[model samples]
Every structure is written in C-alpha cells, then in structure tokens.
Target: MSQTGTIAKKDALAAHPPAPPWAELDASCQLPVLYFLLSGLAWLLVGTLLQFEAGIRLLCPDWCAVCPAMTYGRLVPAAENALVYGFASQMGLGIGLWLLVRLGRTPLVASGLIAAGNVLWNLALTVGILAILLGDGTGHAGLEMPAYSQWMLLAAYMFVGIWGVQTWAHHTSGPYYASQWFLLGAMFWFPWLLTTAQLVVVTFPGRGVLPAITGAWFAGGIQHLWLTPLALAAIYYFIPVITGRPLRNYHLAVVAFWSLALFGGWSGPARLIGGPVPAWIVSAGIVATVLLLIPVTIVALNTGPVLGSRLGQVCENQVLRFLAVAVFCFVLVSLGNALNALRFRAAVTHLSLNEWARGFAYFHGFVALTFLGAAYHVVPRLMRRDWPAPRLVSVHFWFTIVGLALVVIPAAVDGLRQGNELNDAAVPAVKIFDQLRSVFGWRVLGLALMSAGNLAFLTNFGWLLIRCWTPGIRSAVALFIDQSGKSVTAR
Candidate 1:
C-alpha cells in the first residue's frame, strides 16, 4: 500500500500492456490495395453491362444478331472473361495482399511495383476482353483471353504477387497464422496454374482433345488453388475478428489447408469424365472431387461454433453477415461439386446450364461475397473513415443474395430438364429450345438485379473516395451512423 509499492505495480502493468487486437499495417500499403479494388469494381460494372446484353440475347437470340460482336457466343464469353480476369482476379489479389501484410506484421515491400502491376493487369484484361469481342477468343471456357493478353497478365501478376511472397518470408517471429498459409498458398499456386494452362493449351497447342483437357484442368486449379484459398483466408480472418474470439479447433485449420492444397487441383480432371481422354483421368478426377469433402467438412466444423455463437450479432454487422453467407455457400458449393462429379450426375449435367450454375455458385456466390466482406472491413481502416452509406450497403447485400439465388436455382432446374430431354429421343429439339427460352428469361432478370446492386456499391464507394480527397467538408457531407445509430464523421 506504500507509494513505492504502488509505483512498482504501475510500472509492471505498463511494461506488458495487452497488445491491440488488430495489426498496425503500414500506411503506404493502402494505395496499392485501394487501386486494385477500384480497378476490380470498375471491371465488375463492365462485366455487368455485358451480362445484361448476354442475358437479353438469351431471351431473344436475334435481338442484336446483326452485330457480330453482340452475338450470344461472343457476348457471353466476354462477360465471363471480364468478371473472372477483371473483377475476381484483381479483387482476390487486393484482399490477399492486405491480409498477408497485416498477418505477417510487415510493410509491403516494392509497393510501387505492385501499383504498376495492377495497372498492367487491368490493361491486359482490357485487351483480352476486346479480343474476345472481336472474335479472337481462344474458345476455352475459362481461358477465353487471347494468348498475347494472357502472357501480359502473367507478367503483371508476378510483379504484384512477389511482394506477398516476400512479406510471408519476412513475417514476424511467431507461429504462422492460418490466414497467412492460405494467402501465401494462393499467391504461389496462381502463376504455376496460369503458366501451365497457357503453354499446354495455347502457346504449344496440345494434341487433339488435349487442349480441352488442359483448359478443364486450369479452370479447376483457378477455383481450388487460387480463388478458394483467397476466400478462405478472408473468412478465417473475418470470423475471429467479428466474434472477438480465436478460431476454435485451430489445429484443424492447418489440416484443412493442407488437404485443400494436396487434393484441390487434382479434381480438375472431373470435367474430363466421359470425354475423349483416357478413363483413368476421369476416375482420378472423381476420386479427387469426392475426397475434397474432407477439407470442406473440416472447415465447417471449425467455423460453425464461432458463427453460431454470434448469430444474434450477424444482422448488425455487415461484414459478419457477408462472411456467414459466404462460408455457408462455400460448403454448399463443395458438396454440390462432389456430388455432381459422380458418374450419374456428371452424365446428366454435362454440357448443360447446371455447369454454369455451379460456376456461378463458386465465383459469384462464394468468392465475390467474401471479397466484398473483406473490402467492407478493410476499406474503413485504409481510408481512416467509416462507410458513408449503411442503407446502400444493406441494399447491395440483399439484392446480391436474391439475384444469385434466382440465377442458380432456375439455371439448375433448366439444366436438369434439358439433360433429361436430351436423353429422351422422344423429345423434339424445337420443344427443348422453347423450354430454354423461359430459363434464359429468368437469368436475364437475375442479371438485371445483380447489375443494380453492383451499381449501388460502385456509387457508394466512389463517393467515399471523393470525400477522402476533400477533408475540409468530409465531416459535413460524409456522414455515417455508428452502431448505436448515432451520426459520426472521419474527423
């Protein structure tokens, strides 16, 4: 109780104050991440425009038939290429870089190179999308971009991704985090996947049917090795942050990561089932796809409690809601994929809208939602401001969920119907076409809703950035409601 004893106690407490919950990432890294996100969102808008055109064409094939570039074949591919390469790839890289830097507790090295890489990456995508519209598409489902543009994209990706590698290598002395493992794994896998696909399918021109096999392989790698990991990394980080608890069964997360890495890319061969390729290839893909359930189950078990504990808070937190939906969708997609890889289902789903539905579930449903959630969390920290429009954010979230549901549900049903009709010799081709007209009409409605949601997001973000530039009036014009429903400002 003496003054000297009290001073000693105070000193002890000061010496080891608990660390802040979040990382103190360097300020300079914000620009590169922001640039990447902005570019990605811009492309998302462009892709949305293309989606409207493609969707309308589905409803009326001859609506724009006079223009070669507006043909369904070209427009659909163009939309896909824009969404995958432009929006998905860029946003994935941005979120990955941000997580890597934060978790590694290091400043981003060579950030200027990353900025340049981002610009070049966007440029390459632009050229590639233009090429597709001009009928220079490679005709590969995932690799529709021309060879020249792909090479440029690869080069640009290296410039940006190397910094992530360096950050991981220089991570602070401690046990590696689960998020870091996934981010680093994605950065490392992408280049190999891209290069392998390019050489086998485009640069070297594989033998008959080989190109198809290679394309399918590359597409699977992109989903499993690249996009899935990125999404997982975000989910892993966001869940703990939102719930104010560490991830339960932390050791299982490591197993999940390794399982995904080991078994993920091999599942690509599932697409080759019933193809010209050897029977062993198809068998390998089916086995790999089925085995994927291991990791999926592990992830579900690990995150389920964390999400369950916070169910009441999910509605209040935008980031938590998005992440919750994303994780659920991820599990569903994985299960669906495994089941569809079975011989019976694959035979029915092959060359049908069901395949497109599955792709949408992965890219739009899982990956995009996770990335948006991360952006919602990260942007405020980067800009030193809160999101200016909560209402708009809510609108975006609901619209996206509804739109995706519309697309996935209807397309899947139509695919099943078409597949059964194809298997039935009694069904006339004209009747089948007529049936699909209604399916495409539903897809067009979904696309319109999605486009509206994306535009709302874009406008909100644009205003946020503009407010950042004019700090003098930010307090007056850039208002955001706090959790208690009280207005606050960046100041």
Candidate 2:
C-alpha cells in the first residue's frame, strides 16, 4: 500500500504487458472481415466475367440472340451493378471498417451485426442483379436496381455503417487522421446520396427530365463522393506505411480533404451538360469538375514526394506498385474529367465511348487498384499469415495493368475519332462503326485478361485462408483425440 509497493507493481505490469491492441482488434474482426473479403472477391470474378460477356455482345450483336436475359441492355446494367454494388462497395466497406478501428485504436463495435448486414447486403445485390436481367431495371444509370432492392440495400448498409460511426465516436478524444476523416465522410455520404437518388428517380418517378437529372447526379456522387473517398482513405493511410516514410505535405492533406468534400457532390451534373437539364445546373457541374483539379493537384504534390523517394521500394513491393498506379490513375481520371467537362471537349466525348473509357479507368484503374493494395496489406495482418504465393500477386498486378491499358487506350483514342467523325456529317457512319468494332474487339481481350487477374487474386486469397486456419484445425483434431478419442462435436 506504500509508494514502493506501487512502483514494484507497475514495473511487473510493464514487463508482462498484455497483448497488443491490434492483435485483440484483429481477432474480434476476423470473421466479419474475412467474410466480406471472400464474398467481395467472388463478386469481383463474377462481375468481370459479366463485363466480358457484355463486351462480346457489343462486338457480336447476335452472340446470344436466343436468351432474352443476355440482351445487351440487360447485360450492361447487370455487369455495372455487380461490379459497383457487389464488388467495389463490399470491398470498400470491409477495408474501411478495418481502417476505422485501426486508426481510431478502438475495438470493433457490433461485429455480429456487421456480419449479418454483410449477408443481407450481398443477398439484396443478388436480387437486384437478377431483377435487372429480368428486365425490371429502373432504366436509371446507377439506380438500375429496382425500388424494393434499393431499400433492402439501404437497410443493410445502415447496420454496418452505424457501427463505423460508433467506432469513430468511441475515439473522439483522440487525434483524427486524414484517413479517418475520409472514411467517416464516405460512411455518411453514401446513404444520403443513395437515398436521395432513390427517392427522386425510383420511388417517386419524377417528371420526364427530372429523373434523368437525378440519375446523372447520383452516378457522379457515387464516383466522386463515395468511391473516390473510400479509395483515398486507403491511399492516404497505406502509402506512408508501405514506403516507410512519413507523409510529406502533411498540412496540405487537410486542404485536399476539404476541397474534395466540398467539390465532389456538385460535380455530378456535368454528365448532363448537353442534355435537357437546365443550363445553370450544367454550368455548376462543369465549374465543380474543373475545381476538382485543386484536390487532384494537392494529392499528387502531397504523396508525390513520399512515393518518389521510395521509387525502388515501389518497384520491389507489389502493393506499393499498385498504390503508385492508383495515384497516377487518380491524377489522370481527374484531369480527364475536368477537360472532358468543357463545352468543346464534351461535344466530342458526350455520346461516345470516351465517357466509358474514363469510367473504366476511374473505377477499375484508380479505385479498384487502391482497394486491392489495401487488401494485400491488411489481409495478411488479419489472417496472421503471409500470402502463400507471391508469383500469383505479380501475375495479378501485370494482368491488371496491361489489361487496363488495353481497354482505356484503344477505347479513348477511337472514341475521340468516332466523336469527331460523327460531328462532321461528311465522314461516313460506317467508318465510325468499323472503328468501334475494332475497339470492342480490343475490349473483349482486355476484359478477358482482367477476369483472369481476378481469378488469380481469388485463388491467392483462398490459399492464404487455408494456411492460416490449418494450425487451428490441427490443434482441434489433437485436442479432440486427447479428450474423447474421437473428433466429434461435444453435445
């Protein structure tokens, strides 16, 4: 009860030191996080295959003429929904939740509920995809899923998102990092954006052009507000750790964060520039899209030095290489968006494959790559094992890069050519059609390669899980034999 007694107690506790906080947190999160990751990778493979199928349909219109569900209209929307809702959203949630708990130094709250919600979310997405294939698509860009399915998705998201909010709240007294801010913003922004879009476009079915306007806005918000922020959250957090250097331009990260938050939602209407929507809305979108250059510039400058200093590491580390590619794609996508939003550039790119090329680059090249890098880093920690095969990872990265370049470059270049020719009445329509056929052929190849990459990743993920749980499996078998001379469940 004296000072000497207290000092001796403290010294003993320090020497022993209970398990690290991250170890405890990772143990709590293993079930739900692993479930999310596994489901996400499965969906990634399914989505990529669907996309490849859609590309084939584009090239050969009569490829699947007999099957109504395989029609181009149904297939395209189905593929997009599968990739965005099924793959990207699920992966982002898994990665974001882990980042939230790790950066906040807090235990996961309501992990059981998150696991249940994950099941519901995937179920709802499955229903939505089937609905689209069955010709029940809402005919909206991002809101193609039917009204009933949309509500279910929203309900499921809340179950997971609320816990994220609570985790951040539990650590409110601690200093917040840029990554936490981005993750928090994404968690809050998606539901609001999805709800508003559903209300205007699907639930209420606004008058003619209004639904179009709402759909454009919703799609843009998904890209800029939801997906972009989720990707950046991982980028900001992992780059420094992977490079073994502190984030440079620390002060500017705040500037980048606030700038992105302010500008993202307003940039959606740029898609409707030449449409029936009011001119002011279009102007606002264009202005916001251009202003996005601010954050884009800040991000490049901020992370550029850290990445540059570790060029050798970037080449040596697969995850670092992925992150580096993500940064480059982010800059490219932002600049392309700004330039294409202009009146002249929009005139050429508005109704062409140029837009599709940009979307592919942004979604697959930028966002998906960032999430993949984060997954490579976090999965090992959670599983308590390193990747079983490094060669598979290298194959995945190269396939992704080469495939993306194939898809984006050919489609973009040909799209501009097609646009310019279409504008000039003198150029024959057949000429543009021929060029499109070539690009579609290239896309088919690219999608095939990308799908192969997805399979490689999924296989690696499965292999890692087998390695991680093998020890526990052996322990269980040994313990069962010692206790009861049988490996039967105890009643």
Candidate 3:
C-alpha cells in the first residue's frame, strides 16, 4: 500500500471506532414507522374504494355486486381496520422499539417480544382483514374486527407498549423531550382504546344503542390520542433535529398533551348526531369536540413559530420537506375538525363526503404522511446508507400532498352539496347523486397517486433494507456512513 494510504488508515483508527451494531439487532426501529405507513396506505386504498363505490352505486343502478360486504359501507370499516390495526399499530410498535433503543443508549431491551408483537400484530390484522373480505365483518365500522381478533390485537400491542413506557421511565437523558410524551402516552392510550372498543363493540352482547356509542368513543379515542400522538412525537423529534431548532413553547406543548388526551375519546359519537341517542351523550360529544380546539390551537401555534424561520430551511433538508407539508396539513385538518365539531357544521356534514374527506385528511396527513417523512430520516440512519435520490423524496411528498388534496377537497364540496340537498324539502334525493359523481371521482384519483407514491417509497425501503441486511453487499458498496449513519436492519 502507498504510504499515504497507510497513514489514512492509521488516522481512521485513531479517529473513532465504528458505531455499534445495535441498529442491526433492532430493526424494530422500522416497525412502528412501517406500521403507520402501511396502515396509512391501507386507509388510502380503503378510502378510495369507499369514494368509488359511493359514486358508482349512485350513478350505476345495476351494480348489485356492490353488496353490503363489498360496498363502500363495508369497505370503510375494512380500510379503518387496515389502517388502525394493520398499519398504525405496527408503526407504533416500531416507534417504541426505535425510541427504546436510542433512549436506552443500547440495543433494544426486550426487543424480541416487541418483534414478536410486531409479527403477531400484522398476522392478526391480516386474518382480520381477510375476515372482512370474506364478509364476516361485523356491521360496525371501526368495530368490524371480531372480539377474538380484538383481544389478540390487544395482546400483541401490550407486548411492545410496556417496553415503550418503560423506556421513558428509564430514560437517562436530562429532561424527557417532547417526543417522550408523545411516544409514552401513545403506549398507554392505545391498549385502553382497543380494550374499550372491544368490550363495547363486541364482548357485551345485546346492549342496544350503548354499544354503538361506546364503539364510536373508542374509535375516536384511538385516532386522536393514540396513533396521532405517536405521529406528532415523531414530527417534533425530526423537525427540530433536522432543522436544528428548539421546540417553541415547551410549557404549552406539555399542557396541550394532557388536555388533548383528556378530550380525545369523547368526539366520535358526535359524528352520529342524528341517531336516536340520549341528548346528554350527544351534547357531551359536541362539547368535547369543540373543546378540542384548545389543544389543536396550542399545538398548531407552538409548531408554527418553531417551524417559521426554518420553513425556508425546511426545504434544504429532504426529511423536513415531507414533515413541513404534513405539519401544514396537520394544521388544516385540525381546523377542519374543529369546524366539523360545531353542531351546525356536523348537521350538514355528519354523513357527507366532506366528513369522509376530513376523516381521510386527518388520518392520512397526520398519521401516514408524517410517518413517511420520518421513515426517510430514521430508515437511512438505521441502514447506514445514503438516500437513493433527493428528487424521489420530493416526488413522494407531492404525491402524498396532492393525493390528500384530491381526497379531502372534493369530498368536502360533495358533502356540503349533499347536506344542502338533504336539508331542502323541495330537492329530490336523486340530485345528490349527481353532485357525488364528480367529487367521488376526485377521491379515486387521489388514492391512485397515493398508492403509486407508496410503491415508490417501498422501493426506497427495499434499497435501505438490503444495504443494512446483506453483509456481502454492504462490504462491497463502500457506502458513505458517518456517526449519524446507522442502518441496523440485519437480524
């Protein structure tokens, strides 16, 4: 070897040893993130199917294959299950593992159980989804998964959730960061929701309207307090780290977390406003939904200024680019939700396309897009590989953003149109069909692009995985890796 080459090697040895191989033992880093992304993808697909079927059922009369099981009515629940159970729950587990590994400053503690939980969670979701596909789906929306399945799911998540909470309890870092609140709270919130939802929706047979109300509460609870907090924690950790900014309003962030959790499980049945429920239950829902504004406002306000100066800087980094868009969408969806909570808005939108759009927007933008953005940061680090292309990342962002727009905007317009038509005594139900066709078409278009984007994301994921997993390939690649670069996927 040349003298200079020998000198370079000595300098390298003197500089620092390679990062530990914990990331490999703990591919659990990707689990929670993947769960959220895939679940979001499942929701996107289900949401698309819902929009398409609604339009086709209205326009095409002979579409009898559009039976209860296959129709938008059934597909909506299937999609929700796919997202909540299949994707989001898995993602949460991954997040917990990743966080535990990092905060513990070691390889994951109890990661094997966590890994087992991840597999079981996906398996339960697969079986449950197939059950839905086979038409065994319970007539309920979020509660379609059978009681046994729910219990199975509860067990699966419990395995990981315990470790996530313990990670925070054991965190040696100075003060628990904002991400800890999100990650740890999510760990606690979800099992409560899953157990609660199962009892109300399935276990307690013959409970009249109470089951429906309880189920709704459970669904809303998980959506708001559990998965969302997990996603938001990821957003807080990544945005500041990537942008090199501190969290704005640290005190407000903590207060909002508590208030939001308190108010979360109360808004769902409000979506069932006109149902034959007690006046008090509906009133409570209405009040809770409105009060959500406080937390939403606080969060949005906090993120707004923290991300303000960095908005320009956000683009300089690929990871923040996806986050910045999702963050903005988060603000929009929260405001839309606030409006929907208004009894007046709910009256017009409760069962309308706008409501569906709003639902998808919140679930997709907040959960799916945010997690996708995070994967861009977390995955590459774990894999110890450079990103394939910055342009591909940008494409992924637009695909998600534009797709979300098509889904939400048109549905909102169609929903308002349908509601206005319903409210008018003179208008026939037939005219509402005409309004739905054009808007539903938009929803389908959005999902198609979103799905394609996900495929692109999957390709990137495969590359990252291979680099981290295949020792032979990694040894040959001379991939640029620094202290920040760590891809631990290999088991």
Candidate 4:
C-alpha cells in the first residue's frame, strides 16, 4: 500500500480500536452480580438510617426511649451488623466473584448456587437483625447474632465458598495477579473467623474472659482479614486498569500481601488491651498491630509512585480518584490503629468513641469508597451502558468526602476528650457524657450526608437498569399490540 493509504489505516484503527473481549464473561454473571450490588446498596441505606437514629438517641436519650427495639443496646448492634454483613460483606462477595472470574480468564461457574447462597445469606442477616432488635442478641460484641443465625450464615457461606474455590481452581492458565491472591484469602478467611466465633464464643459458650477475647478477635478479623482484603483486591485490580499502566513496585506486592495476612488476624487482641484478658495476649496483639504497618507502608510505596505519575489521569477518571482516596484512608487508618494500640494511648482511649471514629474511617472512608469505585467501573461494563447521570457520580463522591470528614474528625477529637476526662478522678462521668451530645449531633449530620450519597448511587443504578431493559419491554408490548390489531382487522 502507498504511504497515504497506510497512514489513513493507522488513523482509522486509532479512532476505533478493537473492543475488549469481556462482554461474554460479564453477561454470564450479570444477573447475580447486579442483584448483589443492588441489595448491598439497599442495605447500606438501611444501615445508615439506623446509624442516624442511634446517633440521635445518643444526643437525646428520650428521643426513642418508648420503643424497646430502639434502645441503644439493640439499635447500635443491629446497625453494626447491618453495615458489616448486610452491606460490606455482601457487596465485597459480589465484587470478589467478578474479579475471580475476570482475572482467572474463565466464565463463572456454579452461578445458580452462588445466587441461591446470596439469597440465603441476606435472609439470614434479616433474621439476625430482627433477633437483635427483639432482645435475642447473644450480647457478644461481634457475634450479636444468635446461635441459630450464626449457623445459617455458615451454611450459606459453604454454598458460596465451595464454588468460589472451585472457580479459582479451574481458572485458565495465566500468571496470577495480586488481586486474585487477596480475593482467595478473603474467601477462606471469613468462614474461619465466623466458625471459630460461633463455636468458641457463641455455640460452646466459653468461660469468662474467653468469650470477650474471642469476640474481639472475631470482630477484628472481620475488619482486617475479610473486609480490608476485599477492598485491597479491588484496589490492586482497578488502579492499574484505570491508569493504563502496570502498578509500580510490582515485585513487592507479594511481600505486602503475605505480611497483611500474617498480621491482620492477630491485631484483633489489641482491642482488648485494658480488658481483663491475659497481659501476654494483649502484648502479642500490640506487636501484631504495629507490624501491620509494614504491609500498609509497602502498599503505599507500591502504588504511590504510579498514582503520583498519573496525577492528570487520576484527576480525570472518577474511579482513579476513589482508589487514590481509599489508599490514603488505608494508610491513615493503619497508622492511627498502630498508635492507638500502644499501651500509653490505649490506656486513655480504651472504651471511648475514638475506636468508633477509626472504625468509621476504615469501613466507610477506605473499604466502602473503594467498592464505590469498583461499582462505577464494573456495572457499566456488565450492562453495556454508561452511567445514566455522570453528575450523580460527582455528587456521591463529594458527599462521601465531606460527610466522612464531618463524621470522623469530630468524633475522634471528642473521643479523645472523653478518654482524658475519664482518666481523671476529678472529672465526673456524667459531665463527660453530657458534653458528647454536641458531638453526636455532628455525626448525625454526617450520617445524613452519607445517606444522601447512597441515595444518589441507588438512583443512578436504577436508571441505568431501566434504560438497558427498556428496549426489550417496548418490543414485547409492540408485538402484543400488533397481534391484537391483526385480529380486529380479520373480524
């Protein structure tokens, strides 16, 4: 061909590159994945409302005092369970399954079983939340769900997990990505944590401080081992894809991964520092929590340069912005946890709302935000449609950033104040709690903003689904109308 002809061919190819071959894989799992995402978003809204209600009650004890179910004891636990299991875990599973199939270069297997398991899991959560509200909570911090509910969750997990493992096992030949490792770890780690909590703490009824120790361990594992890993899986997978570059320091990713798995579970006991648990256990936990910084720092180092290099791209792409913020939150939360675990700091902060602030930052700011980015990238591809409202995405992002700031910063500062006051013999507990009413007000405002963000997401997703399905609905209606018209003409 002549030079002009070749040049024109190159330009045409640049204008319309070959399409990615992801359509079939995405289609195969579309229904189940969409179900998980939608239900997860619904649960997030539910949990946020409950959180807002609980915050209000804290500010004014008489606000909901008439209803037993609205008591702080019941409402707080129910909210935590709903947010953790109903929203975070369920959403993480959906995202993880997609990553597992995509990264493995394989079609989804056992999708029917996976969907059934997903339904079962949600049903179990609903029952457990109701059980807590009705005063059937076991009173174990993380295992508040009753014994039967725990068993049901475990069974539901087996149906999902067995197939996940099988899918991973049968993955097509390729070098594994870092996301796969984290996804697989999460799939296995959650069951172990839940089973142990059920057996040792709930089902078997451990003696005295053993139950407390076990509960703390279980709670910690859920955050560190299960939720954080799932978040990281998305982070690792999406960062490079969005930036159109390989992750920097790729060699060290394995070290970071293993170190996290090693220390994440052990860090749980740090929460028990001032409790009646064994001093040795507490000391071990402190060490583990501090060591967690190694992996956290490694992650920052691995991803920071690439993100820094792509500052323009990061700004232009909404998903990249979410992952960037997630990384920052992950680093900040890790450092805060390490500092809080120290004996000197833990002495004052123990039993204060400082821990609450940290939990919120980690869960909402880090993990959930990461998933938000993932949803933006994945949902559009699955439906073969772009977001119906780009502006709603921006609205969600801003609301989350501002809302998280309002919630975390004020709560953390006030928690420290409460902790310091509690340590002073001269200060009365009543005065310290009385001062917290204002802090609770700020949290309520934050929760409202966050809930608005959730609503925006839900609305955007609903619109996208409707747009995608509208053609089919219209076609079916038109066919029926045509048949009726022909019959009338014959008559």
Q: Which candidate ranks first by lDDT, i.e. highest?
A: 2
Clash counts per candidate, in order, are 0, 0, 14, 0
Total backbone collisions, model 2: 0
lDDT of 4 by residue, 1-491 (tens): 25335423432332224423465777667766777788888899999889988888887888768899999889888998999988888888888888887777677788888888889989999999999999999988888999988799789888778988888887775688899999899999999999998999988977889998888788778988999899999999888776667888888999988988999888899999988989999898899999999889988998899899999988878788888999999999899999999999998887898988988999999999998889887788677677889899989998988989989999899999999999998999899988988788889999999999999999999998888788777766776877655322210
TM agreement with the true structure for every prediction: 0.91, 0.93, 0.85, 0.94
Give model 3's TM-score versus the native structure. Answer: 0.85
lDDT of 4 at 165: 81
Question: Which residue pairs overlap in candidate 1's backbone?
Answer: none
Candidate 1 lDDT tens digits, 1-491: 25335423432332224432232463657888999888888888899779878888877777768899888889888998898888988888888888777676677888889999999999999999999999999987788899999999999999988877987898874788888999889999999999999999988977798888888778778889998998899888878866776778888999999989988888898988888998988888889889989889988988888889888888778888888888888899889889989999888887788877887878888889999888887776677666778788898898888988988899888988988888888999789868887777878888788888888888888888877777646544544323354455543
lDDT comparing candidate 3 with the true structure: 0.68
- Judged by lDDT relative to the true structure, which candidate is superior, 2 or 4? 2
Q: Which runs in model 4 stand beyond 4 Å of their true positions?
A: 1-20, 484-491
Q: Which ten residues in a row are the worst by lDDT in model 4? A: 10-19
Ranked by TM-score, the better of candidates 1 and 2 is 2
Q: Cα deviation of 138 in candidate 1 (Å)?
A: 1.7
| C-alpha lDDT (0 to 100) for residue 103 of candidate 3 | 46
lDDT of each: 0.83, 0.86, 0.68, 0.86
Off by over 4 Å in 2: 1-20, 475-491
**Using TM-score as the measure, what is the rank order of every candidate, best first?**
4, 2, 1, 3
